[model samples]
Target: MADELELLRHANPVPVDGPHFGDGPLDHHAERHLDRLLRERPTISAPSPPRRRTRLAWGLAATAVVAALALALLFTGQTTAPAVAAPRPLLVQADSTPVPLRTLAERAGAAAADGAPKLRKGTHVQTWSMGMSDDKPPITLPEERIVRWHADDSHTEIVVATDPRHPGRPVLGGDGELVADGHVLSRQTYPPSWSDAPPQSPPPTDLGRLRAYLQEAEYSRTALNTGELLHAVATLLDTWTLGARESAALAQLLADTEGLRPAGQVTDRLGRRGQAYVYDGTGSRQMLIMDPATGDVLGLETTFTEAEPEYGVKAGDVMSYSAWMR
Candidate 1:
């Protein structure tokens, strides 16, 4: 009985490395009580016929009492502490002009009725990317790329690396060659079928058919959501030229989408005025600029809405942007 009591006395009730909900360490009062219980050995009266059994029973009772008291302290500590709240969304500035999203959509739809430009035989796109540089102070550097894809899937690309801070300075190619004189740094041509074929057919012109096409064509492999749909539509416009009917359908689809908010009128990087619509997705914010006069997509930009310290990206930093024209 004494040996058992000694073993119980040394047993630690509080965990040293586990989840603790309490705001502070174990209660001082509880610790003192535990110490006292372990130190003050109970004295039993003179042995009876079942003296051994009596002592064993007494030791077991003491162990149970100590365990109950320890549990009470732990639970009390947890219940008294307050819970932590979730983080709030970061704030971002929007254009001052306030226009209803549906109103802009209607105007865009009307403009689309005017007819779209003739479809060309190839896809041409220009893109700009801003990213962290290796230098001290870690300023974002800008790079530009132009992609041209033939109707048969053969493609060519020209890349230019420029320092945004020194726009007038000449940029050099990787091979120690001067590329600032409107010369391509490096160019490669891929044979037909070297890559996946571009959308050979234009997107559907009806709202229902377009919605279904967008869902299956773009987001079928991944879980679909309103934000993903908006992003897919914006990406589609970047590559595929939309006619009046198709553009009107797209405008209507966006107007009916939940959580699509108007960000008012803003000038794109190309100095073209357009209505902006914003969609908040997981860890990012996508802004689509639509030309209200011609019902055309003028530009698209995505910015980070959450801080990703691992990537050294702060909230509100523009990740990438593209301005496109047929």
Candidate 2:
């Protein structure tokens, strides 16, 4: 894999005006100094594109001037960085005997009656995922990720891929480079967007208001039916730290939603026993496992119930499965 730090440096650049560097050859001593500065300070400001006149002024000796400009830009704070891409959303699937939705909702509501744990200032989630490739013996590219989101909208995440063939072994990148076994393979931190204000409180817990809130929030950008709504709700729960009221409200909303059929009881991938709920739609099945007593979601799994030979995935093949914990 590419060096994570190198990628980060390229992603965060400082904006500057004019051609700060001239065309003259750089002195070896100056070059060494620039290299040392870069090594010691990874967060140097980036230079902006030079104007036509400025470029002409720099002439053919721009190479030497570039080193000096680098130093100047590093001291000046004219930086402009690119936005990081949002994390991929989770998918869902299931196949089992169907349970009454109300029963599950009531259980969840009862659990909520005890009140939710105190909400933290930031969102923190850890997940383990498998099934990305279709190798000869079926490679389940097992990976783990930890994501954190601060109230300011800034975020950080670390992802590690493990060798599926050898449990606990770190997988080597395509270039045959290996991060020390059990070490983080990649990490990224994004600065917050000052324009976006932080939310004053958690999502509403009332059924009506919660539904409306979701519709207004970006979460409802795509039209969602009952089953899809449940899946989205599960995703929200995974992404945010909700209080007991919010959790119970969500359960009640799901209870009232149409198309949710219980898939009996089963132990989730995390070995937690919970009631299984399945939603079938257009060749795909989504299953959610939740604690029967606490209403806390245990796991989510999505499977292809119909064949799609073009993708090399057969019917009943797991599309993706994720287990999240605090």
Q: Which candidate achieves the best lDDT against the true structure? A: 1
Q: In candidate 2, how many Å is residue 149 off?
A: 4.2
TM-score of decoy 1: 0.57
Q: Tens digits of per-residue lDDT for model 2 on 1-326?
A: 32332232122111012131121123465344324323432232333221111001122233333343455447755253111111122322256444566776787677667675544333322233322223211223234444455465655544554322233333332122333333455555556533321132356777887776655443456556865675566556544656656767777787887776776777544344567777787898878776666565656676778976554557777655665444
Candidate 1, 1-326: lDDT as tens digits: 12322221222122223232221122555445434433433332232220000011123333443454456447756332111111122222373674565776677677665555444333323344443322211122233333345565554433444322233343333332222322344334445443222233467777776776777656375545876786576556554656656666777777788876877777654345677878888888888777665556666777888977755667877766665544
lDDT for 132 in candidate 1 is 38
Candidate 1 colliding pairs: none
Q: How badly does each model clash, as a count of residue pairs? A: 0, 22
lDDT on C-alpha atoms for all candidate structures:
0.49, 0.48
- Give TM per candidate: 0.57, 0.59
- Candidate with the greatest TM-score versus the true structure: 2
Candidate 2 global TM-score: 0.59
